[model samples]
Target: MVKKVTALKPKDESISAYVRDLIEKEHRARANREAAVVYQEFLDKNPEECAAMEVWESAPLSDEIEPRKP
Candidate 1:
C-alpha cells in the first residue's frame, strides 16, 4: 500500500501529505454516508411531511427575481 501510494502521489508531494488527503477524503465520504442514513430515517418516519416536501421539490421556479429586503 505504501509503495502504491508513493508511486501514485505527485512528484513534489510528501507521502504524509498524500496520505492525509486520502484520509480526509475518506472521512468526508463516511460522514456523508452517515448523514444520508439519518435523513432517510427521518423521511421514513414523516411520510406526510416528506410528501409535502416533494410538492415543493417538484414546483417550478419563478423567472422573476425578488429583490432582497434591506
Candidate 2:
C-alpha cells in the first residue's frame, strides 16, 4: 500500500497530501450517494410531486442558455 501511494503521489507532493486528497474524494462521493438515497425515499413517498419533477427534469434547455462565469 505504501508503494502504491508513493507511485501515485505527484513528484513534489507529500504522501500525506495524496492520502488526504483520496480520503476527501471518497467522503464526498459517499455523501452524494447517501443524499440520493434520501431523495429517492422522498420521491417514493410522493408520487404526484415526483411525476411533476420528472416532467421538468426531462425538458431540454434552450439553445440560448449560457454558461455562468466563475
Candidate 3:
C-alpha cells in the first residue's frame, strides 16, 4: 500500500512583510529586556529614588506651565 503526502500552503501575507514584522517584534523584545535590566540595576542602587519616582508619577500633573518673562 502507498501513502499520499500533502503539502502545506503559504499564508496570504508577503514573505518580506512577514519577515519585517518578525524582526520588529524581536527588536522590541530585546529593547524591553535591556530596559528591564537597566531599571532593575537602578532600583538596586537607588531604591529610595525609585520610590520617589513612583510617587511623582502617581501625582497629578499641572495642565498649565508658568511662562517666565524675559
Q: Which stretches of candidate 1 lie over 4 Å from their true place?
A: 68-70
- The weakest ten consecutive residues by lDDT in model 3 span 1-10
Q: Residue 21 deviation, candidate 1, in Å?
A: 0.8
Counting clashing residue pairs in each candidate, in order, gives 0, 0, 0
Instruction: Report the alpha-carbon TM-score of model 2 versus the true structure.
Output: 0.78
TM-score versus the correct structure, for each prediction: 0.76, 0.78, 0.56
lDDT of model 3 at residue 20?
75
Worst 10 residues of 2 by lDDT: 58-67
After superposing candidate 2 on the true structure, give the runs of residues whose Cα lies further than 4 Å from its correct spot. 63-70
Q: Between prediction 1 and prediction 3, which has the larger TM-score?
A: 1
Return the lDDT, model 3, position 19: 62
RMSD to native for every prediction? 2.1, 5.0, 7.1
Runs of candidate 3 with Cα error greater than 4 angstroms are 1-10, 53-70
Candidate 1 overall Cα lDDT vs. reference?
0.94
Q: In candidate 2, what are the lDDT values of residues 1-70, reduced to their tens digit?
A: 9999999899899999989999999999999999999999999999998999999998888757778999
Q: Model 1, poorest ten-residue lDDT window? A: 57-66
Clashing pairs in 1: none
